[model samples]
Target: MKRPSVSDSLKRLMAPHSIAVVGASRDPAKIGHAFIRNPLENGYKGRLYPVNPGGGEICGIPCAPSIADIKGKIDLTVLVVPAERSIPALRQCAEKGVEAVIGITSGFAEAGRAGAGFQRELGEILAAAPFRMIGPNSEGIVVPKSKLQLTFSPMFNAMVDGPVRIMSQSGGMSGMIASRLAKRGVGIGALFSTGNEDDINTADLMEYFADDPGTGVVLAYLEEIRDARRFVKAARRYRNGRAVVVMKGGRSPAGGRAAMSHTGAIAGDDRVVDGVFRELDVVRIRDSHAAVDATAALSMMKWMRGRRVGIVGIAGGFGVEMTDLVETSGLLAPPFSDKVQKKLRPIMPFYGAVGNPIDMTGTIINQPDMFRDVLNIAIDSGEVDAIVILLTFVGEPKIIEAVIHANEASDLPVLVCWTGGGEDTSPACQMLYGKGIPTFDSPAAILTGLEALKAQAGL
Candidate 1:
């Protein structure tokens, strides 16, 4: 029989037909209990087998005494047992021919010298075993589309389906990114928390997501890179086709020390990492919120054709501010050409400016179509490659509809920076999000999103 390739194993690991939970517990307080309960609650379609020495039933499902007792082929297995017990449990999985495994138990590698020895033993077992493993200290995986909540995270309850995929070394950071994106009305297709990377490292998953058609953007949170060569190769494969936004930790000496203790990962020099990322054409963002903003934009917007942005706003002051932001963000805000300016003159009020920013003044409050007209003109013009609309306290449905219509009718990316108006403007924002248009609450976030889109487009 042909041995399954690592990619094949990863496919099974991501969307398993049958899963076994080793150390499945009846106690609700334990992570073992959450592992089984989460899948059951989330409507996982796969067959589930919970293994426990003293088990009869867990979460209303029959429990086997061990993986050996499970009668059928298991595609994936999750181990939540103690570190000392993980070795024997893994040996049982190897004997049972499990295709993939996730060791959720901590204590090995990250727990100092004694634990390192244990990790070495586990590696030896995997070397001879047919199945590949994710981690001995990992939080496991979550595939929202498959209803595969393999981890014990409570965030799964709120996760929606979208094109963004998150892969992080820190489980907490992974959940944090997912939650923040969710709050912004952006959803993730899958989340992979590669805890200790005992076997399946970041580069492996990067290559996997590179081929995942459903994923449009990959949001990664990294503490360190274990294999630079493999990482660069995988990144290059994906960079041209999909947007790869990375938020790297451990830039400082103090942060580096913390990262070492947290994941047993050695932090690389920041300058070298930055250079490698730049060479790979990867988008490296330092702030978590900004990273999510970038991911959301990349997931929603089309690739920008160029760095020239057409800024349109209801207020003149914000138009000036956004012009400054656009120029500072390495984006161009050139004045509209004579023909483009002629097209905009009639739509603008006499008091309004009809230059690059195109401040339509307060006239748009009564004439909502003005917003859409300006967008269409900007998009149709050969001058700009993207459009950014600034709305302050204007939440009319017609105005929101205009933005959506303009976005759908053009290949150019349209972004909105909506401030003030509180609840009145929220529905407009939600409507834009529903139509797959990128919207931001602040000017800074909008620029970050635009920068990400430009970078991904290689503009």
Candidate 2:
């Protein structure tokens, strides 16, 4: 019989009828505990069974000894036992007719020859059982709609319920990026970590998210392309007129060696991989944060009507730096027209530079209203499709407020480069974050983030 596709498997994985935790533990530090606690704490709307031979009730919930002892059907099982014990647990899950299994235990093929043999044997056993598997060394999956977090990352936040899905190979990177996106109130429909590539791959997740109604954008972090041709086909199909940003790691020989040591997967030609991404209209990124920023921007804003960008900075030096970066990035900082200059001239103080990269200068450093006035003129004048406001750390208490108000007022996407340190870093970062504005510490990070947004908008 023909096997079902990954899209079909993900359906059962994301919204299972009954879920069982095979290695449930009482300790909160264990991955098994996270797998069990996250779902129940988040108010998972499905039946949860904890399987442990020595288990009594955990968190006031009854624990079953094994899958065979469970009364009803089991749709999903998370195996968190030692590497050697995973296959037995999987066999038990298969016997109970469980549709899918997510193995979070590590030390599989990534370990060595014996481990690779163990992983292959496990795969062969699963093949006959007609069950879909996520990983022998994966961090597991997260589905926010069900309020389920199967990974052991505490940084995961359940914020804005947007139409974006993230598929990453690094668990730590995924958690960090997800946390950053959550701070911006950008919701993710699903997040999956494809560690070791033992069974499930990124291509499967891309195809799954393509059909998912809740997913409008996809952010991918890949070290290798297991099936490059098939991945491109799925990526093109899922574009949805939106963007798919991919960050391919393992570029240099050193990086490839490190990646191989981590996941035991071959690192392919990075240049050729990038070419394929360009051919398929996939926006390639350099870092995980770039992927997150691009996904957030593209998921919120539409394509730019024009590539002409306007720079509004608090100082001339910052504006010059921004211009250099933007121009070098294949984007243009077209000169503002005479009419735009005339309109903006009266609002600014006498010291401001009023050219393409308009410099608001030090006059507005302490004034909150100046932030709003300059952005309003540029957006209202139709001279620019996007605006970048460079702000140093010397602004007033409500400096972020001014930027937030300007962002809300303009239809065009706004980028904020907040540089400096003050009494409260959390509150200051939170204010801009609350409004969905991208804030960066360095000018280079700001330009890179904006460039990603530009690519997503096809500017």
Candidate 3:
């Protein structure tokens, strides 16, 4: 496989011979301050060059008043300057023969015409220059291998290292998801936010991640596709190395209206986008939780072993809803064969929804050991490839034990859906999450995660 475009550029940015922060600052509140602080605070192992007209030494690094003050070829320049100042900074970077520029500035196309004009000008500058640009209005990019946290978002500095690479059109969403995933113990290998995507779009980044050795899954959140053809082609090529899971906004007209007004995105036919997603084999998320949950599952679990899945939940109604999701999401829930049914019949005394859904009734709530026994039977029967364990309320300690045991016993990936609300079982949920089982409060999100896993594994 060919190397991704972003990886080499990323290596330069993360561990450049010298890096200049164009809008380097002393004030802690400013975006520039955060950008400079990340590398320093997180112990980024690279040469740091701070740039500011008034600079002497900001953040204890030797400051350069301008890009020219650098002694040799500067590998990367991070633009934390204002929207109007980006062009001059790009000109300086081009003059300095910098390999890449991370535009952490906003107020580009996302801010409308004047901002759009500024973004266009920056693009023209890059076109005439020899360097690559990550964004004109991006949060910035991160390459874990180089320990580079180029974004101004404070969260990136605290990121956990993992095999997934993330790209988003919304910087805030990207930061938010990355933060939450880190909290859940899933680190990202690289992260990019192509704000407005005037030049370095998601497709280009996806292509780069496709060949990146560290990346196993690519998680994306888009309001629109700037380059559809490149995205499809890249996704197809990356199918094995990196699975692309997307969460696109603008489904309803209300949502579409909001997306357009928010990011100047042209919200076209969502169904058409869906079809394109299908063609590219990209998994589209329905909600925020699904994005993180699907990322965890896809990054950790194998593809679906079979189309048929046994969804056993302590809650009867939640199991029923999961069954509905399975059918609608195109996964088959074939009825259990008589031989398998006989094995279950002797164990399950109460008449639950004993079809493919395999509702354990409230039996597991009382007899937690039964949960493991039932799961082992379900997985062993060769009737289902995956299991969805739904618990309404984890009031019993046995249930938790059973879940842990079941997870250990089964090779098939198990997704847990814990229904009900409030703080009663947050501990239990966290416990399950710690064990590498994706846990969710919403059955819909859990099912969505499973559906995405099935789609990616090509079951």
Best by TM-score: 1
The candidate with the higher TM-score, 1 or 3, is 1
> Of 1 and 2, which scores higher on lDDT?
1
lDDT of 2 by residue, 385-424 (tens): 7787777765465676767777787778677677762112
Error of 2 at 381 (Å): 3.2
Best model number under lDDT: 1
Name the weakest run of 10 consecutive residues (lDDT summed) in model 3.
251-260
- The alpha-carbon root-mean-square deviation between model 3 and the true structure, to one decimal in Å, is 5.6
lDDT score of residue 440 within candidate 2: 63
Ranking of candidates on TM-score, top first: 1, 2, 3
Candidate 1's displacement at residue 284, Å, is 0.6
Whole-model Cα lDDT of every candidate shown, in order = 0.82, 0.75, 0.74
Per-candidate count of clashing residue pairs (backbone under 3 Å)? 0, 1, 0
TM-score of candidate 3 relative to the true fold: 0.83
| 251 Cα displacement, candidate 1 (Å) | 5.4
RMSD of each predicted structure: 4.6, 5.0, 5.6
Task: Write down the TM-score of every candidate.
Answer: 0.91, 0.86, 0.83
